[model samples]
Target: MRSLRQTTARWLAAAFLAGAALAVQAADPAPIELAAGVYMVPGTGGEPDPANLGRTGNAGFIVGPRGVLAIDTGTSYRHGQALLAAIRGVTDQPVRLAIVTHTRQEFLFGAAAFREQKIPVAMHQAAADLMATRCDTCLKTLRSLLGEDAMQGSAMFTPDIVFTDPLALDAAALIGRPIQLLHYGHSSGPGDIAVYDPRTRTLFAGGLLEARRIPDVGDSDLPRWREALRNLQALPVEVIVPGHGPAGDKRLITQVERYLDQLTARARALVNAGAPLSEVADATAMPEFATWDQYETTHRRNAAIVYLRYEREQLVK
Candidate 1:
């Protein structure tokens, strides 16, 4: 009976290994048409793994009358190039502008590819400042997280133009429409921007909302992020191209808001209850959130950030 038990354990271990191997070999994101000429490539998995190479962030493009407007460049050179190929597969039109919504390494690193195409990159001024000042640290951390091979040939490039105010753009002109870059003020990150296209009624909300993934609070001001979501809730867009995962709708924004609210409310409760920052993750663990990707890896960090935020707010008061 002992020998049989040992054999059963070995079989289980082998099966688990097989499953992990299959998951590691998962495929890259494929572009899906969000609207008539608006296309978004939905990302797979969570976080940067050797398999996904941190391609978990969504990148999109719009076929405008004048030229194509590439949304985020993606995480690396090859990923950016693959997106370019996908853009070509749709239309042979020239790409005009690449607008970034955040200062995250994954999205900003791919700007080099667009620059090579002679297409200028643009970003919110706050994002430009953050990236410009922290480029070296971001690159070093990314190299560690994504592995050298995935980051190979990738370089961080700041936007050519930095805008402090909302810009009127015609990237959707190819489809005979106009799109605007809207900044709703400090959510998700300091310079989170949303690409709003009234034609198809789609909003490319970069890093502002990651449907199906835990909202990253690493660099976010929770209250500000919630406020941003509230602003998004008022938008009339039918479809939202999130920073991560598939293209979704207002429900995505709603869902993210709920999660943010819950995280804040729950974390605040724990902190008030005298729970240690280190223990808040377990104390506030939501069964409903158990199935979410990267929960185990990131939940504690989220709790810790909220705890620190609470501490800081008290100090300010």
Candidate 2:
């Protein structure tokens, strides 16, 4: 019986290894066309790939007579170049307008590719300012997360057009409806905009509503993030383009709100009980978040941020 058990275990281990190797071998990079004008560009970040086998970012295109409007660039220059090529594949029309959902490099660095083409990049004023001041830090962190290849490919590109609040852009050439930039409070970063396409009723919510994956709260204010998500709930959205995961429906935003609620509650409970940051990190497990790629990456970092705020609150009282 012992001999049989050892043989079976070895076979099982070999089978698992073979399956993993096959999965890696089959994985392909670049974007996939989800619809006529829309494409899903996967990321090549060094971090554990998203469940979709891509990095945590997406780009979109809407072709019209005036020109093509592309939404959010990917992490590296290669990603951006690929995105532009994918857009051209959809329509020979030059990219007329490029708008960003946030200030994160994963979503903005690709804008550099569109510059010489004279495509105007649009973003919120706060994001433009934050990009100017923190571009180096963002670049450094992305380099750390994605390695040298991704770092060399990424370049800082700020928005040429800045909107203080909601602004409707009419791309006369694009096939989609006018794009609306609705400013939600500072949740993910200094600038979080809900990119709404009236025709599709699709809302490209940057990091305000991540689905399945853990929220990146490195520079987040829990209170503000909560408020921002709440504000997002009011929009009549049909589809949601998340910053980090597969595109889904309105439930994406709701699910994220629930996670934030739980994360905030857990942080409060730990602080109330006089637990140390390290202990809280060990204790807080986002049981509801089953699809997170690297559980430790976001969980520990989020806990640390919550702990910092918790300690500040305690000191105030």
> How well does each candidate superpose onto the true structure, as a TM-score?
0.86, 0.80
The residue-level lDDT of candidate 2 at 96 comes to: 75
Q: Give the number of the best model, judged by TM-score.
A: 1
RMSD values, in order shown: 10.1, 9.9
Error of 2 at 93 (Å): 2.8
lDDT of each: 0.74, 0.66
Name the 10 consecutive residues with the lowest summed lDDT in model 1.
Answer: 14-23
Task: Report the lDDT tens digits of candidate 1 across residue range 161-231.
Answer: 77787654434543345887777777788888888877767788998987667878987877778887888
Expressed as tens digits, the lDDT of each residue in 80-195 for candidate 2 is 67678877766786787787878776677777777756778887788888889978886777666656775464677657788776544544334344666667567777776766
On a 0 to 1 TM-score scale, where does candidate 1 land against the true structure?
0.86
